[model samples]
Target: MPEKFDIHQPDDRFFKSAMSDPEVVKAYLQHFYPKIAAIAYLSSLKLENSVSLRPSLKRFEADVIYRCRFQGEADGRFYFCLLFEHKSKPDKYVAVQVGLYIMELLSSMVKKQGRELEPVLPLIFYNGKEKWMPQTLSELFQEHPHFIALEPYIPNFRFLFQDATRLSPAALLELVGVLLLERTQPNFVLIEAR
Candidate 1:
């Protein structure tokens, strides 16, 4: 028989522990994905009371599990599944990882809804050393010699908030704290690289 290696997944317990300190959570979320700060805040409202963390999956493990209503002031309901994966080190295979996450979320949704499959939009929060540069599959074909045309609608957004001089004492302290928190995990690595 083949051996099955032991695998671990972050649970609601981790989420609860991490979020026990509101300031820490707020700073982490704000620095990671500013656009989603409001949304994360809204979702965290019910986190302790209703949100289920690390919901069972068929295969891959999700880092953070959350459920929040995307309520429209007039429309009333827009339910979404916010799945988070915390990475301390860069994964060269991030695209594949994200793709898998989307697939899993869709499959779970299909079973939950008990209906035909529908396209789902997923938001991925990446917190790793290497900057996430998501490019279209077609972009891979750009060869050197000849000039490849540039599209007006290049869809790449880079988020860089890590400058030594710019970081306040408090921010630096918090950053170090997060690093220390994840030190026990194998994925932890020094992110002091330029």
Candidate 2:
């Protein structure tokens, strides 16, 4: 008998393994993460050991973190957290989850080394069949008389989102090519030739 394959379940293992590879991660960021690529060099990105907020909390299961030095800036560092969503349905509270994870990362750094809060860029990669509509934390909130008045007091944060299902075939092919080249050649520079 042939083995059965499940499509609805989240493949956290496969996503984590691919994102953990230095070359694959670098290529991914260079091609998909424009804002981050603008501030940091791909060569400077170093994958950090995944940190757990608590033993009871398994939020870090589908997430990967990277530490990188800011280009042309002394004493500048950035934390990039990539959270993968592989389920068929999108979570309505994904922003809240990401915000909590970011706070946990900051808290961990402060407790361990007393370092100043570093800027963290939270990115979400969704490959589900459903289209992701929400873009910011504020979007998930219900509009009410009091809520409208207190909007300024609420903590607002936005995460970069990429839906693989929406990408064109040519663009997907380009990304694949880039990943292959990067994997084969460690020193491959992604910058276009002058």
Top candidate, metric TM-score: 2
> How many steric clashes between backbone atoms does each model show?
0, 0
Worst 10 residues of 2 by lDDT: 79-88
lDDT of 1 by residue, 130-157 (tens): 5554433234334533424543333322
- Model 1's lDDT to the true fold? 0.46
Assess every candidate by TM-score: 0.46, 0.77
lDDT of each: 0.46, 0.67
Mind giving the per-residue lDDT tens digits that candidate 2 earns over 1-194?
Answer: 99998754445555666677777877787788777777776676777766574546654643688777777766653433444333345888887777777777777768876466677777776777788754466665546557787778777887677777788987876766654665566676556559
**lDDT of candidate 2 at residue 50, scale 0 to 100:** 65
Candidate 1 regions exceeding 4 Å error are: 1-34, 39-58, 71-77, 114-170, 174-194
Candidate 2 — which residues are off by over 4 angstroms?
1-10, 55-62, 74-88, 178-181, 184-194
- On a 0 to 100 scale, what is the lDDT of residue 55 in model 1? 51
